[model samples]
Target chain A: NAGVIQTPRHKVTGKGQEATLWCEPISGHSAVFWYRQTIVQGLEFLTYFRNQAPIDDSGMPKERFSAQMPNQSHSTLKIQSTQPQDSAVYLCASSIGLGEDTQYFGPGTRLLVL
Target chain B: QQQVRQSPQSLTVWEGETAILNCSYENSAFDYFPWYQQFPGEGPALLIAIRSVSDKKEDGRFTIFFNKREKKLSLHITDSQPGDSATYFCAANQGGSAKLIFGEGTKLTVSS
Candidate 1:
């Protein structure tokens, strides 16, 4: 298995620009999650989808951040007007089932906003 | 506020020694706890997990000792090796919620 595939392992964007990260979940998985990892906050959940439906996005920033799972096989996280604080490793994970199931993760996309 | 917390941000141990990492959670509803280990430049991988009903769970050289009353749990790595050095994160899941609450990781260093 390729596990979960995240495109553009690294991304750098200037401040005020838009940044988009993509994730391709493993086949047959029903749940996908997005997380951001930084030295200060550690790994924090941003949003999640179950069977291509948005389940929870409480972790997302009130503004500038949004996520969408148009279909079961893929999802995207977009940040508009990106700032330096947005620079971090964006991780994507998928689970075979809901709640407490083992999550398989992608290597992550390292985003740098200058 | 963070729901899960881990102690000793970093720890060092000599080869063949035992290393213990501690974690505690504030939400009593959390029943399933899992530990993930991450190497540099790689995503975190599930190591071992335990449920509230069981006081302990062992897998090979790794063991988890959980105390439901105290809302605390710990990961113990026996016969540690240099390869065991990595960041360890403790996570909690409640009921049927697919979401997890993670604790700030504990960085472990094993020296030969």
Candidate 2:
């Protein structure tokens, strides 16, 4: 198994620009999760999708952050009007079917907003 | 507020020695706790986990001691090695919830 695959190992965007990160979950896994990791905030949950449906996004920033899982195989996280403070490693993880299952993470996209 | 927390921002241990990493949670609803280990530039990987029903969980060299009443847990790595150097995160999730709350992490370094 290739495990989870995330595109653009690193991303650089200027202020006000938009950044879209991609994640392809492991085969047969029904749950996908997005998280942001920073020096100050540690690892923070951004959103989650189960079976291609958004289940929870309480941790997402109300305005510019958005995530979607169009199918069981992949999910995406988009950040609009990216600011310098938005720089962080965006990680994607997947599990068999959620509900206390083990989550396997991808390499992550290191986003650096300039 | 941080729902999950880890102690000792960083630690150093000698090879073959036992290394202990501490964690605590504020939410009593949290029933599943997992410890993730991350090397520089890599995403965290699950190293060990324990449910609220169990006080202790062991796997090879790693063991987790959980205290349900105190809302606390600790990861013990026996016979530590230099390769064990990494940041360990304590994460928690309530049953049936898809989201996982993570702690700030504890960086451990094992010297040979």
Candidate 3:
């Protein structure tokens, strides 16, 4: 199996520019999640989707962040007007269903906003 | 609010020694606990996991000790090796929720 796949392993954007990160979950997995990792914040949950429906996005910043999973295969996280504070590794993970299932993760997209 | 807390932001241990990392969660509904290990420039991978129903789960040199009442857990790496140096994360899933509450990672360094 290919595990999870993330595109543009690394990204660099000028301040105020927009960035979009992509993720392809393991086949047959029904749940996908987005998380941000930084030295200070550790790992913060951003959002999650189950069966192509957003289940929770309370962790996402209201104004600049949005996520979508149009189909079972892939998901995207978009950041608008990106700031230096948004420079961090964005990780995507997937599992068979949820809960106790082991979440397999992708290598993650490293976004560096300058 | 931070729902999960981890101790000792970093630790250094001698080779062949045991490294113990602690974690505590605030939510009682968290029934699934998993520990993830990540090396620099790589994504986190499941190291070991334990359900609330069990107090301990062991795989090779890694073990997870979980406490339900105190809402605490610990990951113990026995016979640590330099290869084991990485950031360790403790996470919890509450009531079948897809989201995982993660503790600030603890970086472990095993030196010869």
Candidate 4:
């Protein structure tokens, strides 16, 4: 298996610009999760989707962040008008399902908002 | 409040030594515990995990000793090697919650 594939491992964006991160999860997986990782805050859950349906997004910032899983194979996290504080490594993971199952993660996309 | 917490912000141990990383949770509902290892420039990967049904779970050289009464768990890495050095994270999930609550990672360095 190819595991999870993420695009543009590194991204640089000007403050106030929009940034979109992509994730292609492992085949046959049904659950996709998006998280943000930083040295100061560690890993913070952003949103999740199961079988192309959004399951929960309580962790997402109220204003600028949004996520979508149009299909079972991939998901995307988009940050609009990104700020310096939005800079972090955005990670995507997938699992067979919830409850006691292991979630496999992708390498993550490092976003630098300058 | 942080539901899950990990101790010893960072730890350093010599090769061939045993490095123990501790974690605690405040939620009684959390039944699944997982330890993830992250290398620099890479996302975290599942290292080991345990369920509330068991007090101890061992896989290879990494073992998880969980205390249900105390709501604590520890990951012991035996025969630590330089390659084992990375940031280790403790995460918890409840029976229904799909997302994991992660603790501030504990950075480990194994010196050869």
Looking at model 4 chain B, report the run of 10 residues with the lowest lDDT sum. Answer: B38-47
TM-score of 1: 0.99
Candidate 1, residue B49: the lDDT equals: 92
Q: After superposition, how far is residue A112 of candidate 2 from its true place, in Å?
A: 0.6
Residues A20-107 of candidate 1 have per-residue lDDT tens digits of 9999999999999999999999999989999999999989999999999998889999999999999999999999988778999899
Per-model tally of clashing residue pairs? 0, 0, 0, 0
lDDT of 3: 0.94
Candidate 3 pairs with clashing backbones: none
Residue A3's lDDT in candidate 2: 88
Per-residue CA lDDT of model 2 for B31-96, tens digit only, reads 999899999988899998999999999999999999999999999999999999999999999987
Q: Provide the TM-score for each candidate, comma-separated.
A: 0.99, 0.98, 0.97, 0.98
TM-score of 2: 0.98
lDDT of each: 0.95, 0.93, 0.94, 0.95
Candidate 4's TM-score = 0.98
Task: Report how far residue A22 has shifted in candidate 3, in Å.
Answer: 0.8
In model 3, where do residues sit more than 4 Å from their true spots?
Answer: none
Ranking by DockQ: 4, 2, 3, 1
In model 3, what lDDT does residue B31 have? 88
